[model samples]
Target: MSDILHVATRKGLVSFKRAGNEWRANAPAFIGQPVSAVLADARDGTLYAALRLGHFGVKLHRSDDAGASWSEIAAPAFPTVETPDDNAPAVDMIWTLVAGGADEPGVLWAGTTPGGLFKSSDCGATWSLNDSLWNLPERKDWAGGGYDLPGIHSVLVDPRDAKSLTVGVSTGGVWPSADGGGSWRLTGTGLRAEYMPPDLVFDLKMQDVHRLSACAAAPDIVWCQHHNGMFRSIDGGETYSEITGVKPSVFGFAVAAHPSDPNTAWFVPAIKDELRIPVDAELVVTQTSDGGKTFASQSDGLPAVSYDLVYRHGLAVDRTGSRLAMGSTTGNLWTSDDSGRRWTQIHGHLPPIAEVAFG
Candidate 1:
């Protein structure tokens, strides 16, 4: 299990270190600033934080000596467009960040708002946008779910091959690349979108995938929390099968797949998109140990009767697959050591958490 936990919140980036049986909070970095994403790269012990400075624009920072110190790095930007009709969209926020494979040192991938993917070879020194995905003609059909424009929230790099990648866009659907994003194709079949017209219900391009997570040991076993319901993929997102009839509700924004167990995954359930709150005003994390065939509602230490909602990146499981951390928009946080059987509240108030990561 990891002894450190990093939380990106609406106010700032906060870190916690495990102290015996308790987690102690460290002096928060970027305090009072909205931290949209945080990545604790285990490859080189480097820490990265993405800040959304509203009117000031997006900014990124790197910390080599953990959270003790940090320096601003180059944030991803769109290339200048000469034609007025070909107006390139600016990056509104850095939604997610992931380090390259062990063989590729100093390489990083970033998913940003307005549906753009960027790559860096010299850490965060410079970035180049993936023009292949940006120039997709079908990109015009992609619409926004929560933000003004669609965003790529989940970027899954297959453990077996660094060149193989899968990205989850809010309203753009699932995209898989075979040649390090040199080429791309949409292939999320079996995903049903009730929000769309009946004729386009099965259209992959219209499915709103809130989050996508894959088991580390078995990268092909992927889990998805969709706007319509929960889905599972055994072939690395080429296709998915909706797992319906989950208790409470299958509508949620966050999903976490166990690092080792392909059949085991966790989801934070809510009422629905129209009513984004805990079922019966009670928060719970549902667990599926049998590949979504069955579910167990686990809510030992979470709020009994309250309104707390977890975002797309709010839930995270450590590398050990034994420790899990969950943060909420209401500023509540919890940790579970025995999978999802039981949980312990680590902190009651921090800030509106955007992402939780372990290192």
Candidate 2:
């Protein structure tokens, strides 16, 4: 089980430390500022926090000694392309941040709004835009989901191969790169997009993947919580197979995969895309231990009549695959000690959670 849990909220970034069985919150950091994303790198015990200040712009901070101290670092910035008529796209938010593989220390990968990927080889001292993915001609057809421009929120680095990466884009589809970010190919074969036209329903680039999680022990098994429904990929996201007929509704933004068990995964379901709330005002978590063949609704400690919603980054499972943490848009936080069988509400009155992670 993890001893530390970090939550990025609409107001600030909160950290919690587990003492024996009870988790205690530390003095909140960056209060009164909206933390867009938080990353606790297990590689070197480094913590990275991204703050989205309305008028001050986006800022990135790093804490080498846990949360005791922090220093401002260079946030990912888009290259200046001074075309006479075209304005270079600015990075509005760092949607997702992940450290490189175990062997590659001081390396980081960041996915940003306006649909761009960045790489840092010097521990975020500087960043360079991936021109291969950014200059792709197909990007012209990409559209946004929640934001005005398409954003890459999920970046999965193959545990076995640091160069192999898969990213899930909203309003865009699944993109896999075998030689790191040097080249890219759009996948997501069996995914369906009901929001698109009949002819474009199966278009790989038209599908909206809410989030993507792959089992660390079984890297080939990838789970996708898509805008249309839930999907699973057995071959490392090269292709996908939609899992349908789920209880409640299949519309949700978050999905957390067991770290060791490929067949075991968790999903927080909502009514649908039109109604982003619990099914019939009940917030329940659906778990599948046998791939997606069967699902069990685990809500022993959840609210019976609630209106909380979990975002794509709101659900997370620790390295043990036994400890899980979930946060909601309604300021509710819960943790499960035995997978998803039951949950214990930690905080019900925190700021609206944007992301949660266990370190």
Angstrom error of the Cα, residue 32, model 2: value is 0.7
Point out where model 2 deviates above 4 Å.
83-86
Candidate 1: tens digits of C-alpha lDDT, residues 100-206: 88888998999999999999999999999999999999888888976888999999988899999998999889999999999999999999998789999998889
Local accuracy of candidate 2 as per-residue lDDT tens digits, 165-275: 998899789999999899999998999998788999999999889999999999999999998999999999988888999998788999999999999999999987677
lDDT of 1 at 53: 96
lDDT of 1 at 169: 95
Error of 1 at 106 (Å): 1.3
Measured with C-alpha atoms, the lDDT of residue 36 in candidate 2 is: 88
Task: Give residue 138's error in model 1 in angstroms.
Answer: 0.6
Can you give the TM-score per candidate against the true fold?
0.98, 0.98
Question: Each model's C-alpha lDDT?
Answer: 0.93, 0.92
Per-residue lDDT value at 206 in model 1: 92
Model 1, runs deviating above 4 Å: 83-87
* For model 2, the run of ten residues with the poorest summed lDDT: 79-88
